[model samples]
Target chain A: MRHRARRKVNQFILHCILLLGGALMVAPFVWMVLSSFKPSLEVISINFSFFPRRWTLANYIRVFREVSLGRAYINSLLVASCVTLSVLFSATAAGYLFSKLRFRGRDQLFILTLASVMIPPHIVLVPLYTLMNRLQWINTYQGLMFPFLMSAFGIFLMRQFIRGIPNDLVEAARIDGASDFRIYWSVILPLVRSALAVLGILTFLWNYDEFLWPLVVVHDNRMMTIPLILGHFTQAEAKFPGESMAACTLVVVPVLVVYAFFQTQFVKGISMTGLKG
Target chain B: MVAKRRVFNTYIILVASIVFIYYVLVCVWPFAFNLYLSFRKTDLLTEDKFIGLGNFRFLWKDPIFWRSLRNNIFYLAMMVPLGIVTSLFAAALIYRTSGIMRKVYTALYFAPVVTSMAAASLIWQLLYYPKIGLFARILSSLFRLDPNSLTFLQNPTTALLCIIIMDVWKDSGLRTVIFLAGMDEIPDSIFESARIEGASEWRQFFSLTVPLLRPQLIFVGAIYSINAIRLFVPVYMMTGNPPGGPANSTKVLAIQMYQEAFYGLRFGYGATISMVIFALLVGLVILELRSFEQRWEY
Candidate 1:
């Protein structure tokens, strides 16, 4: 009975600590949401209150009116979707070839791909910008979407997943005279559905959150993505904290909703991505 | 049979060629071009003149370059250990709990990671607003510090630290989850045996858990260090009037590179700075790998 009581006390202490930590983790987001609802004057005022004195939609209305936020949203969706689909197609094809096909210089090429992962985007920023300029692709979707069409990380991930698939299955398909493309499409693709989903979601998220490339490549307000618009909103129009918070809320809500629905898959994908130790 | 073999070979060659061409154009060519530009005096539109080591000499003489490098080191020093320890502690606590509570806590912590950095930085800037900000209000109430006087981002002494603290808060959730996953991988039998031997929770943690968590710790350290070295968005967004300002206190290498290349239109100088960043990251990665090797067998 005494031991049971000790365990209960320990659990209570753990609960208190975790609850506090959880609150700390979530408070900024809550504050962001609440401050968005507060009147503009109240948001920047000295009076501290968790609850808004008089809630308003003025900020949201102002955000839509003043900024190209709607266009930015559409741009973000288009870029993310295109990049995700392109990465999936390229990564899976390359991954299947690397994992299943026997070819000359395959290992060396794979190593080269892996080495490219270590090259930070900043390192190549100047040349890439110049290349985009030369191609007349600046301020264009093609420039924004081209560099990220496939990533070393995506190829590595797909390769790892594809390698895990049984050789017997591929052999059986081959015995029936299935073409390489047919085998890849019908047999291999379905088997790696979970990996595809994870890669697709991750690719989309990364592209959506991308800032620097978009900031550099797209000078046109109409071509700006969500992060770029948020940067502009904060830097240029941060005087109105309420409207800025509302803009933030808009920028964050879609990702948050996606995360909510796919929390488990998201967590699993993050862990499996080798990003975590 | 010949036709079939030809088709198979064609498919392989076609797919392989696509991957090769894409990577060469996007990755390989840009890297080579950056290297070449680093050695030349050019601003993309100007006549390219080969002036080997000139850019490096310029970088060597630039005090701002050194300051940015120092600031990056400071960020790395503060963020890595603090992030790891706090997240590890949180992970341990969460690992002890089970059911819906764990999921709720995990989701709450991870919310910030999913939020775009621009949005996160903007929200944090509001929080750190001197007079009316939440932080100022809390600190003033707790320690009687003048809330109106505490300009966290404006004051050079506190600016970088404020950003570090925000980064820690934003990142600890992901770190916590990673640590929890690592902890979960440890066999329960060892813990049960340790408990049966009358070992306290702390003893089991130190003796069994910490050693086992070395890989995770090293990995988290390396990643966070890489992130710290390349820190940009917060500095860009949070420093208000001038992006990396209040006398350039928050200036980092990545931000410096951006300013030099895009804003200053000195592509060669920017490429040199990027090379410096690359060298620094490679050195850190090597150090992390060495430590990882020395500590763990598997």
Candidate 2:
């Protein structure tokens, strides 16, 4: 009985430690949200407040009113959605082949795909820009979305997931006289829905936050993504820190909402990707 | 089985072609062009000149290139191990805890990962303010430190270090989750046996966990190294895009490449620098992956 009580006390201490750590980890974000609401002068004031003195929606209103934030938001949403859909389409089709098919040179081709991941995007940045320019894609949606539409990581992830499915199920589908594409769409796709979800969310998040490629490829402000737009304001470093803060908040909020909704799966996928790599 | 094999062969070939073309265009073709570009001299308005590796010769002699390369190494040195240690510590603590607390802690650690790079960069910009930001105010209050006069970003000596510090904080959480997942996978039976043998927690951790988690450690290390080397956003934000502030103290290789490609409009020279970065990353990745494969005995 005494030992049980001791164990309970130990568990309580551990829980308390975890809760405190969690709060400390989350404090910056909490601070960001609070600071966004605080008046601009109060934001940089040495006398910081955990809670704001005067809570207002002024910053957000300013974001929409002052900057071209709405257009950037729409651009980010459109590009991210397109990238996610296309990555899914390509990766799923390839994954199905790699796992279920036995074509010649499949292993050689898969190795080739894997090799590309090691070549950092920066290495290809210049050449890709040149290519995009030649295609008259510079400062266009196609320039922003085309190269990223097929991701090595997404393909790798889907391949791993598909590899785990039983061979018998695929054989059963074939025995039923289903066409290969039909089996892929109706059968394989449903089987790997979880992987697709993981890939989609991950791709969406990455494309939404992508800055460098877009910065290089798209010079047109009218076509700017949120990160690129927010980047311009921050880079300008004008006296109006309020509007920049507003823009930053505008860029952050939607992703946070998506994260909140799909926190578990997204995190699981991210964590898994890290371990796998 | 024969029919299935025939069907599989056709499908695999079809898939292979698409993936092959993608790899060729996105990965191989551009890389070849990057190499080709590096050897030539080209401005945006002029025709590219084939100088047979003139850019390499110039880069080898360029003072700024060498300085930026050194600064990049310094940044990586500070960022990588600090990030690894902090993350491992956080992961260990979380692993020691239970249920609801675990979920809460995980999400908190992951918040920065979910946040956009631009947004995080801006937040850190404010946080590093010499007079009004949290770091400065704390220093001033506690030790009478003259934090009000110092602007880390504007000062060349402090700019790179400041960015390194922020990168560690933002990136450590993701590393922690990766380490935590690896730690969770270690069989409890092994630890239990160690405990039964009268091993202390520290001894058990150092003796068993560290060695057993080699593959995970290598994976995290390699990925972080690659990502850290590609550091662009914070530098772009903090140092006003040219990076290397206060007479070019913080200018890393990637920033230099960006300047060459986009700002200077020396497309060929920019491509050359990009290729150098590519070669370095590829070498490191190959070494790490080989070791990871060898260590992954399970």
Candidate 3:
């Protein structure tokens, strides 16, 4: 009984500590969200408060007016969607083929793709930009989506997931006179739906949060993505903490909401890929 | 299977050809171009002139380049281990929670991970503002210092450390999840046995849980280190008007590369930095994997 009480106390202390740390982890964004509603004067005042002194949408109004975050949101959405769709298509086909179809040098090709994942995006930034310029893709949506069209990790992930299906399933499908693409589309796709979701979310988030490449490629405000515009404000509008926090709120709140909605999937997929986030 | 091999053969060829073409265009071609550009002197204006080892020699002696490289190594050293320790603590504590408390704690911790670094940096910059900043005010009162003079991102000494702190805060959630997943994979019976044997919880965690989580520790360490080397967005967003400021205190390889190629229009020099980063990335990954194989055999 004494020992059980001691363990309980220990567990209680641990919980208290974790709760404090968790609060610290979340406080900045919460503060940012709140401060977004502050007028410029209170935002720059000598005292800090979680609650704005006076409720106002002027900060958000400024961000919307000056930055055109609406266009950036659509741009981010379009780029993320296109990249995610392409990665899924390319990874799905490559994965299915590498796992199920026996071709000459198939293992070698898959290994080559696998090896590319080791190269982080930083290494290719300089050359990829020049290549985009050469192809006249700069400031175009194609520029934003081109390099990410096929994900090496996505291919590896899909192959790993697809390889788990029983060979007899594929053989059965083939015996039923299913076309190669048909088996891939109907039989294989449904089975790996969860992997697709995970990969799609992971890819979408990574591409969605991309800052450097877009900062390099997109010169037009119309071409600005969420991160790009947030970066723009940071560089250009550093004086206005109100507008900056409002921009931060606008960019981060939606992601946080989607993340809250898909909490388990987000954690599982992000922890699995250890991607962007 | 053999009878229908012809049909499979045709389909595979088509798909493989397309994938192979993409691989060449995106990965192999650009990678080769990066290497090729490193050897040439062309700033996108003049005609290309092969420089042989000129760029590498200049990079070897560039003080700013050396500073950036030193900063990167410093970042890798500080960020990864501190992050892992925090993660271990957070994850261990989290694993103790049950039911809805677990979900709430997890969500609370993970809110930062979902936020983009760009946005997070801006939020953190606000908190780090010398006067009237949330943390600055709180810390000033706690330390009996003036809020107006509290220099976090402004001071040369504290800039990189401040960035690392924010990063560790943002990234710990993801690392915590990874560690928690690893802990879940461990059998509860191990801890039970430790308890039955009169081992304390601390002893059990140290002896059993941590050792059992060796694979995850190494994995998270490597990932964090890789992420650390490519640290740009926060630094870029946080330090403006030359990107790496406060006397280049927080200048890192990625930022240096960006400034060189994009800002300075030194394409050759920038490619040289990329090559250096590529080398470091591959070398570090190889080193980590090798250590994983050889160092932790117990």
On residues B63-127, what C-alpha lDDT tens digit does candidate 1 reach at each position? 99999999999999999989988998888889999999999889988888777888888999989
lDDT against the true structure, per candidate, is: 0.85, 0.79, 0.85
Task: List pairs with backbone clashes in candidate 2.
Answer: B244-B251
Alpha-carbon shift of residue B246 in model 3 (angstroms): 1.2
- Candidate 3 lDDT tens digits, B140-252: 78998877677788889889999999999988888899899889988888778889999987898899889988878888888878887888999999987788888999999
RMSD, one per candidate, in order? 2.3, 2.5, 2.1
Pairwise DockQ winner, candidates 1 and 3: 3
Q: Can you give the DockQ of every candidate in the order shown? A: 0.59, 0.63, 0.65
Off by over 4 Å in 2: A1-17, A45-51, B1-14, B296-298
For every model shown, what is its TM-score relative to the native structure?
0.96, 0.93, 0.96
Q: Which stretches of candidate 3 lie over 4 Å from their true place?
A: A236-238, A272-277, B1-8, B292-298
lDDT of 1: 0.85
Model 2, C-alpha of A30: deviation from truth (Å): 2.5
Model 3 chain B lDDT-worst window of ten: B1-10
For candidate 2, lDDT tens digit of each residue in A176-276?
88877887888889998877887787889888988889988988878999888877766655355556666776677777787778778877888887676
Residues A171-213 of candidate 1: C-alpha lDDT, one tens digit per residue: 8898899988998899889998998898898788889988888
Residue lDDT tens for model 3, A1-277: 9999998998889788988988888888778888889986687676656798789999888888888899999999999999999999888888899888886788889878877876655678887888888999999999998878898888888888888988889889888988788888988889988888989997898899998889889898899899988887676544788898888888888889899899988888777765222
TM-score, cand. 1 vs. native: 0.96
Runs in model 1 deviating more than 4 A are: A275-277, B1-8, B288-298
